[model samples]
Target: MSDTILTLTGVQADIAQYHILQGVDLAVPRGAVTMLLGRNGVGKTTTLRTIMGHLVARQGVIGFDGMDITARATSARARLGIGYVPENMGIFSDLTVEENMVLAAVSGRLLAERRDRIFAAFPPLRTFWTSDAGTLSGGQKQMLSIARAMAEDRKLYLIDEPTKGLAPAIISTMVAALRELKDGGASILLVEQNFAVARALGDHAAVMDDGRIVWSGEMSELADDAGLQERLMGLSMEGK
Candidate 1:
C-alpha cells in the first residue's frame, strides 16, 4: 500500500457561481493527523466538502488509496472507506444514540469487534446509548459523531470543526479521543479553528487563505511562529 492515504492536486471547486477553492493542493499521509487551519471563511470547510464529494471538484485530482475519486459520488466515496463528520456533527436529532450507531454500523458493514472498539474508545457514547442525539451536550454530540464514523471501519476521515462551541473540559476530551484515533492508525484531515486543540493533536499543518493553501509543514513549526499564526490564522496571544 502507498504511504499516502489521500492526495489532492491543484483542486478547484465552486458552489454555484462562487468559486470557493482555487488550486488547493493537499495530502494526508497514511495514519497521520493532518490539520487544515485558517480564519473563518477561508474555504477550509469547502475543501473538506470537496474531498467528501458533497461538492465536486471542478479541476485537479482527488486520489484516495491511489485511486482517482474526483468524480465519485458521496456514497461511493464512503464505500471506499472515506468517513466524513461535518461541522454540524451530522447526527439524526430524533434518533437515540444506539439507533444512530446501529445505522452507521449496518451501513458501513462494520464487524462486531469494531463496534465494541468504538464504544470502548468513547465510553460516554456507550453511556448515552439510550439518549437522543439531539438531547446530548455539545461534547457528547461531537463524541457520538466521531464514534459513528469509527464504527464504519473507515481508513480516512474528514473531520471539520470538531471542537467548535465546546467547553474547555469537553474540548480536552475530544482532543484525547482524536489522539487515540490517530494512534490507532486512522488517517485524519481535520479542520479546526482552535490552535491549542490543533497543536495538541495534529501531526502536520496546512494554512489556507483566500481559497488556497499558503503554507504547510510540521505542526510544531506553525505553533512556534506567532507571526505566521497572526498573518494566516488571524490569531494572536491576546486572541482573535
Candidate 2:
C-alpha cells in the first residue's frame, strides 16, 4: 500500500468560464491530517470538489489508495471510502438529527458502533437526536455535518472550513472533536482559515494562492514561522 492515501498530480479544473485549481499537486498521507490553507478565492474548495468528482477535472490525475481515480464518478469515489463535509454543512433542514444520520449511513454496514463513537466525540448530537437539523445551533449543525460524513468507515475525509464563523468556544469543541478523529487514525484533508485550529489538528500543511499550491511542510514548522505564514498566506498565522 502507498504511504499516501490520496494524491493529486498537476490537477487543473474550471468552473464555468473561470479557471480554478491550476496544477494542484497535493498528497494526503495515510492516517494523518493534511491542512489545506489559503486566502479566499484561491481554489481550495475547487480542489476538494475536483477530488470528489463534483467538478470534472480538466487536466491531471487523482490517485486514491494506489489507484488512479481521476475519471471516477462522485458516487464511485464515495463508495471507495472518500467522505466529504462541504463548507455549507450539507444536511436536510426538515430531517431530524437521527434521520439525517440514518440517511448518511453507508450501505451494508451496522451503524451502532460508529454512531456511538460520534456521540462520544460530540455529545450535543445525542442531545438533539430527535430535533430538526435546521433547528439546531450552528455549532450543532456543523457537528452533524461532520458526523454524517463520518458515520461509516472511510479511508479519507475531505472537509472544508469546519470552524468558519464559529465562536471561539465552539471552535474549541470542534477542534477537540477533530483531534479525537485524528487520534483514531482517520486521514483527513482539511481546508481551514483559522490558523489556531489548523495548528491544533494538522500534521502536514499545504498553502495555495491563485489556484496553485505555493508551500507545503510540517504544520509545526509553519506555526513557528510567523514571517513565512505572512509571506505565503498574506497574514500572520495568529492574526488571521
Candidate 3:
C-alpha cells in the first residue's frame, strides 16, 4: 500500500458551469487526519463531493489505495471502503438509530461485535438505539452519522463540518471521538471550520482559498503561526 492512502492531482471540477476546483493537488497520508480548511463557499465541500463521486471531476486523477478512481461511481467508491458523513448527517429522519446503522452496514447488516465496537466509540448511539434518528440531539445525531459510517469497514472517511452549529461541550465530545478514530488508524479527510478542533486532531493541514489550496503543511506549524493563521484563515488572537 502507498504511504498516502488518497491523492488528488490537478483535479478540476465544475458545479453547474461554475468551476469550483482548479488544479487541486492533495494527499491524505495513511492513518492520519488531514484537515481541509477554508472560508465558506471556497469549494471545500465541492472538493469532497468530487472525491465521493457526487460530482465528477472534469480533469485530473484521484487515486485511492494505489488505484485510480477518477471515474468510479459513488456506490463503487463506497464499496471500495470510502465512507462519507455529509454536513447534514444524512440520517433517515423517520428511522430508528439502529435502522439507520443497519442500512449503512456492510451488506446492509451489522454484526453484534461491530455494533458493540461502534457503541463503544459513541455511547450515545447505544442509548438512542431505539429512538428515531431525527429526534436525537445535534451532537447525538452527529454521533449516529459517524456510527453509521463505521457500521461497515472503511479505509477512509470523508467528513464535512461535523461541528457546525454544535456547542462547545458537544464539540469537545466530537473532537475526542475523532481523535479516538485516528488513534485506531482510521485515515480521515476532514473539512472543518473550528480552528481549535482542526489544530487538535489534524496531523497535517491544507488551507483552501478561492477554490484552490493556498497552504499545506504540518498542523502544528499552522497552529503556531498567528500571522499565517490570519492570512489563510482570517482570524487573530482577539477573534477578529
Best by lDDT: 2
Off by over 4 Å in 3: 237-240
Ten-residue segment with the worst summed lDDT in candidate 3? 231-240
TM-score of each: 0.92, 0.96, 0.95
Show how many residue pairs clash in every candidate, following the order shown.
0, 0, 0
Instruction: Write model 1 residue lDDT over 1-240, tens digit each, in one string.
Output: 238899899999999999999999887889999999888898999999999999989999999998999999998988889989999889998999888887776373657787677777777877887888889988899989888888766889899999899889888878888888888888999998887888888889988998999998888888887887888777662232
By lDDT: ranked, best first: 2, 3, 1
Candidate 3 lDDT:
0.90
As a TM-score, model 1 comes out at: 0.92
Query: Which stretch of 10 consecutive residues in model 2 shows the poorest summed lDDT?
Result: 102-111
Q: Regarding lDDT, does 1 or 2 come out ahead?
A: 2
lDDT of 2 by residue, 1-240 (tens): 239999999999999999988899988899999999989999999999899999998899999999999999999999999999999999999999999988887784437898898899889999999999999999899999999988887899999999999988889888988898899899999999888889889999999999999998999899999999989988786544
Query: What is candidate 3's TM-score against the reference?
Result: 0.95
lDDT of 3 by residue, 28-145 (tens): 9999999998889998999999999999999999999999999999999999999999998999999999999999976978999999988878888888899999899988998888
**Quick one: RMSD of model 1?**
2.3
